[model samples]
Target: MDSYICQFPGCFKQYKNRCNLKRHEEAFHTENKKFQCVHCKKILSSKQNLKEHEFIHTNQTPYVCREPGCGLRFRHGSQHSAHKRIHVAIKNIVNRSSVVSFKLSNIEEDIEEEINPKDMMDFTLPLIKRSQDYILPVI
Candidate 1:
């Protein structure tokens, strides 16, 4: 069976059937968007794309981290899982530290110490600024 290749620039997606290829082209390459977001006036090709876009307007991030004092929320499951890994890494670092007593008082004091923003950026945590409006790309 011959595969149908997408003609879109920088997109080399291929499909086993012509119908699937057509769908992909309509979703990714076409200028006409059937689904429109009510809040941001963003246009999307499919219902699924519109649904995901709606989360940004609603500010509804259901996936929240369970760590104490860390109230980070994420819209996607993949992002949520990645944020959890940061907590795991911090926990491992604390465990391996020379502080053998592991008292709550010591941990609280350590956390209270002010760290520079540049130093915090070294950990590569997703620190989103809520003060600015995030613009979504139109399909």
Candidate 2:
């Protein structure tokens, strides 16, 4: 039988066939959905879902902001050109209904101000480091 390769980008692990991919997803990703979201405390069925869920943490919106008192928001600013608006006020921040937020201590600024790309970029990262050296296995 031809080797079944996991098609997910960066997942080089090959299986006996395509069925193995399903098994891998079930065992390592889907089976243990024990880790819960800290803010909304939602259950995650897989790492991909967990990663996507993190966008809520930053209140990211990829769609055109069309409501009144809105400018525009997109997962990528490139989509801004596709947006058409008539009556929305200039928006300083993108509004996402499901995002979780908390007040900053001793700061009068609105909590929305905390929705910063600098802070959010870290959470979106897949890995903290890429090292050529590998850790030695314990005896």
Candidate 3:
């Protein structure tokens, strides 16, 4: 009997045939996830989905934008990166202009001082509302 091995790193489980190995790979290594959330009991389709779902239960936003005044936080890295791109575009526009080149740190400090927690809360409420409109219905 030939042993078929899983090629995934750290996954050394072997199978007796190619079909069994394929089944094992599909069941374990594939993006398909079978785990259910203990809190909401929501069935996430993948590990990444589960991670993002878990964040919905917490108030913490781990991915924070570091572009000075833009203290916006995101639950997902992709969302944060998308937001950063906006800043990059703005910086490029400013660099090309003949106007006084303003340092983001200096501008950010002034903006940060004016922005309060209530202001942030007000800004986020609409985003939360908009996000709800796009949420996929639970299957």
RMSDs, each prediction?
Answer: 15.2, 23.2, 18.5
Model 1 lDDT per residue over 18-129, tens place = 9778867887889877999999788888776677679998888878898999988888655888899999987765554434444544776897667666786677756876
Flag clash pairs in model 1.
none
Candidate achieving higher TM-score, 2 or 3: 3
- Candidate 1 residue spans exceeding 4 A from truth: 1-36, 45-49, 98-139
Q: For residues 1-139, could you state the per-residue lDDT of candidate 3 as single tens digits?
A: 7899999999998877897677567656787658677789987655665676688888657899999877999987668877999999777665544233234445777788787788776674333533321222222
* Superior by lDDT: candidate 1 or candidate 2: 1
Clashing residue pairs, backbone N/CA/C < 3 A, model 2: 62-75
Per-residue alpha-carbon lDDT of model 2 for 29-130, expressed as tens digits? 555665577778987765545655666797876556666666567653324544543332222122221121212232436555767768876776467566
Q: Report every candidate's CA lDDT.
A: 0.76, 0.55, 0.71
Query: What's the CA error at residue 57 for candidate 3, in Å?
Result: 0.8
Per-prediction TM-score:
0.39, 0.24, 0.46
